[model samples]
Target chain A: MPFKAINILLLPLLLLGVMVGVWSYIALKIPGFPTPSEVWSELFVVLSDPLYNNGAGDQGIALQLGNSLARVFGGFAIAIAVGVPVGLLIGMSKSAYTAFNPYIQILKPVSPLAWLPLALFVFKEVNTTAIFVIFITSIWPIIINTALGVRSVSEDYLNVARVLQLTPFEKVFQIILPVAVPFIFTGMRLSLGIAWLVIVAAEMLTGGVGIGFWIWDEYNNLNYAHIIIGIILIGVIGYILDTVMGLIADFFDYRKRGRV
Target chain B: MSLKTFLKIDHVDKVFPLGGGKEYVALRDVELEIRENEIVSIIGHSGCGKSTILNLIAGLDTISKGTILLENKHILSPGPERAVVFQNHSLLPWLTVYQNIEMAVKKVLGSTLSASEIRDHVMKYISMVNLDHAKDKYPGEISGGMKQRVGIARALSIQPKVLLMDEPFGALDSLTRANLQDHLMRIQMQTGNTVIIITHDVDEAVLLSDRVIMMTNGPEATIGEILDVNLPRPRKRLELQHNEEYLRCREAIIEFLYSKFAKDDE
Candidate 1:
């Protein structure tokens, strides 16, 4: 019943929805589950409203969404660009791997939220604070994945390159890069997911116009329905972002004989 | 210039230094002269440095003593002039059959052919190895036999004067091994290229070589003897096996090895 071979998950989901509806009805006789209709209508108003309504300072939902994307992308791009090359260097040399791995290990466990106060104190800009959180949150996965990817290259490939008298640049570009691509893409996907997750939490801690602050403000206004709606939106968007990255990673990993 | 010596291995010796002061003598005072278009097969037990000699010829490793001159020139490093087909084939796993062949061909023959011409040139050698059907497949998608074919095709595509094979068929199954042996002989006879194959199988050496060089076991290893195989050309499998000349040469090599080593019962 939990897993239908026919992908009949909709049956269980529908049953769960009905159970929630029946439970809401029973709760209506008592107190506060904010009927399903309340949640939906609240989501509808927030999505369609021409004004911010929640004092996001005149920026609508669409504008806030775009701003959030720009901040996340800027930080995520920096993480990938810096992390992959450093990882490749570490992967190729035992000395470098030994020296750098411990530093990364030490830094990796420190949460993005832990960086929040320092970021606020030093950066002094809301966007920069969010960006720092994202950059720190996403970098380790990319670096670790890239290093693992580079280390996985076969000795046969190395021997062939050696026999062919491949220049170091040519060897790295033609042989090393193509073989390491799957690992790099895997790292990128992980970093992108982490960046998206971190930004939401960062937004909540540092009051801004992002979806996180919107949800927190809704709770402050005693509008629990809008808060639930914001949570659903955040979950849905995060899922979509992860799915897109996953598809891209799969495409690169399986593709044969492509450019270096 | 007579074809008496295309390569001269003058008193070559390789000593591998194991850590903590232990030293292993891999080869000692080894001398060899390979002629043009001659198929010289070397047979030996494991740890005899048969592969060490091949790597030295390819300049993949430095000799601790002695010199190897290819076409009367000193070898400094691996170049396109002497192409090698290794035992494991060492095909780049990411490339298709066509692209793997194209790699060496592209580097050596780049100025000689245009872009489309290089494609045709690569395809010609792939089909020469009977791998036209597996053109777009990666090495991992192919069998062990097919992967070795790709290695042969890659080496041949560069059109090197000497083709150095190091126990290439040793890793293959018996049936595929036999099939490849036939394929190799047919190609060698057709091209008339000089080749040096290293193997341990008595029959394989007898079947493939113009001369078989039997090597002694190491402490300080050296060539035991060289036996010329005078079996007729365009060799027939069933006929050659039964021929007196072939049997006489085969028995001579077997007897010589047994007498030299531990064939006391014979």
Candidate 2:
């Protein structure tokens, strides 16, 4: 990074550190307030434990985390497979757009949690319902972004495509897909966040082996420390997933097309 | 059977159905013939559908009441035979300059050409538009003029028979427009492809065309006059900007436009 930009960036971080330091000092003054050391100890146990750390009852932390990842990744991947093509189809043809957008509009506002009861009854399996929740939440962003990208393809590009006698398949691949990448990535990033959110909610309802169920179970057990651990873990995991997505998005956004 | 009359547009009319069940005529009774190696320009006020005529020839849009013929064949769909360079430089933002042209070649000439051949063709065309150094840069990274060059390169790479340009330089600043006009005229001469350009700029119409077809404004648009540019070939901007014929043609167009158009007619 340039010195100027780096300095500009550091200014905020320094301010944040000072603010956090002051907050921590003020927090320590309060009676019955748990210090950072206490939080750290609680966090350590969850991070290192083989059992009962932040698991879904008897299930281990590693196993539950793995299960959550699987459901999230699985549902997210499926959403991309279904959402992007559908988005493109929705974005491209006039008739397709007319039909598809209404359905998307209806689905967009309906919370993924609302679908939990249906998913539980229809799926009759804990893991499937959890995956279904992720699917419901993640699919919208991918579809909406893909549609926006495809729809927003420049008129000049279309003219060039038409004049060049580009096959519809070639037009989609060569013209539409590339133009739509930024939008697709935006959707994917959104979908990943949604996947995490919906999966957690679904886990609570389905009572399955994931972080969400573990968090709820800790509350039932009256272990506030374990509950805090579960909450911190959720935030940490969510941040990491979002950061990774942002990096991927930035990579494509900065990557240029042909000369000029 | 002469190559001169490679493209013929006959009695074209376009009408748009407006609000309240009425209609607006965008173009009416338009007829034109462009030769294999000539540059024909259409000039008019805004909304006269000069671009519409070019669109009809390019087959981007259908003419409501007449047919457009290219190479003695009726134009029903867009083909590689005629390439259009639009006013906006429509470089796909995701693709680099090289890929934009390569896409044209790859899509149109894919079955006939290999990868190396496609690269060679695109590279040659990109360089032809003086964009060789920027071939790897995407559209967002480039200047607007450079993007338009990519548009031109993509069009020319196909070796199109007739080039349809709709105010290709209208979006450009004066300096870039003049520079590209020189490049375009030279390219047109070298390739000997017939070109029909639509523009509202009188100087541009006078500078680039062999003959200027003047279009009048309207709710119902039609040609006001056709003025032959008798100015000598390979014009210098500074010289021609002050030439007598150039001034005469400009004056005639201005008079026709102000007298006939510039009105609020229902």
Candidate 3:
């Protein structure tokens, strides 16, 4: 094989091998750490019957993953349903932007964990608190990005709408929505990533039937191998969710597709 | 050739507020009367408020002083009656050529026409601009000339009373500009719609207009002269190249622009 092509093909595997070597060395040095093989074996055991039901507290990996995804999607949908219209209003009117910008600026930088106490106090239920955390974490990116998108719409397009004498509703649906699609999808993609991240953290705190809770439970039991497995699964799921959103963003990006 | 005044711009002035209690006068005492089916071209150097005039007539910009009336009614705001073909051929990049034309047609005539009628109306203008094969292509996929053709098609599809063009072919190359100018002439001849074109090209102003309204330089630009283009209709581009009347009209506009209101830098 040519040197460059071989470098491209072998570099990632080489890196992975080095990582595994380092991990194994760390396991040998540490008393309670799981080795690569131990985690691999535990992953197989967990994957063997992922949907296995063992009552409320001891569900299989697949069911836990399902629970995490359900909470993330539920909170993310509600965030979208509220964020987009509020973003449009803020973006369209200068007054609304001025009125709301202070709150957005103050609230946006706050960590989702910071909201957990307040959410738990208000919601009381563990499930609602977890979902609230996801909602609060994800909503800011969506609102800000959507507003930016709407604001960045070319004046030429709006001039076209005005000259055409399109009704206000028609202007929104036909012109603004179409032009803002890429921006909206961009916001959604960011929010989805944040939602996935926040859901795991929230579930860990709330103690639910999710992957985060499963990891916590494994830690309490001193099953370091299962903890390693759970960490890998979370990373993989987060990567898959981001990739799916990227695909959707590409599909709707008229500028990239050159259809617009 | 006196005819009924189809549109009137009476002593119109435009002042843009620059904040801090200061203002900029873009145009002042700009008066004009456009007869029915008349093709008028406004020509000037850059920053001369020629486009400001077109925008005022199209109701895209509000007049600071005086009134603009079309068909004996005040032109208050932008409406379907004055369809503007913008300088950059602002075709919605996301929409196909057919869809772009169909959008204007559906918006203007959807209430009065059947679905098939609307489709036919859109297709007629699309074919009028000789863009039948390109109807399915997006604006990004087409050449500049083709995009301009679609812009014209979209504007004409509405069957507007006055077709307002703001340097419509300014972005195209010379050959493409000539091609669109000819296409515009042919379409105007067929449709008999009143047109007001803003141009920097002297030949274009002479070739396309019945009267070329020349403007002075800006900050307070006003009509310096109006050259009557008495060149006959159904004029051929190749034939008119050596024609005396065409040369005369072209020369008059050139003299007015270069000699009468020549820029300080020139």
Best by TM-score: 3
Candidate 1 CAPRI level: acceptable
Candidate 1 whole-model C-alpha lDDT, 0 to 1: 0.82
Candidate 3 structure quality by residue, lDDT tens digits, A1-260: 55798788799999999999999999999998999998888889999999998897799999999999988988898999989999898988899999999999999999988989898999898888888888887789888988888888888788889989998899888888887878988999999988887777788888969988998898899999998888889899999999999998988888888453
Q: Which candidate is the best by lDDT?
A: 3
TM-score of chain B of 1: 0.94
TM-score of candidate 2 relative to the true fold: 0.88
Model 1 spans > 4 angstroms off: A1-7, A10-37, A50-62, A255-260, B218-221, B252-266
How far out, in Å, is residue A125 in model 1?
1.5
Ranking by TM-score: 3, 2, 1
lDDT of 3 by residue, B89-151 (tens): 888988899999999888988999999998899899999999899898999999999999999
Query: Residue A65: error of model 3 in Å?
Result: 1.4
* TM-scores for all predictions: 0.88, 0.88, 0.97
Span of 10 residues, lowest total lDDT, candidate 1 chain B? B257-266
Over A123-207, each residue of candidate 1 has an lDDT whose tens digit, in order, gives 8989998887888887898889888888888876776777778888888877888778889988888888788777777887887
How close to the true structure is residue B139 of candidate 3, measured as C-alpha lDDT? Answer: 95
Chain B TM-score, candidates in order:
0.94, 0.93, 0.97
The DockQ score of candidate 2 comes to: 0.53
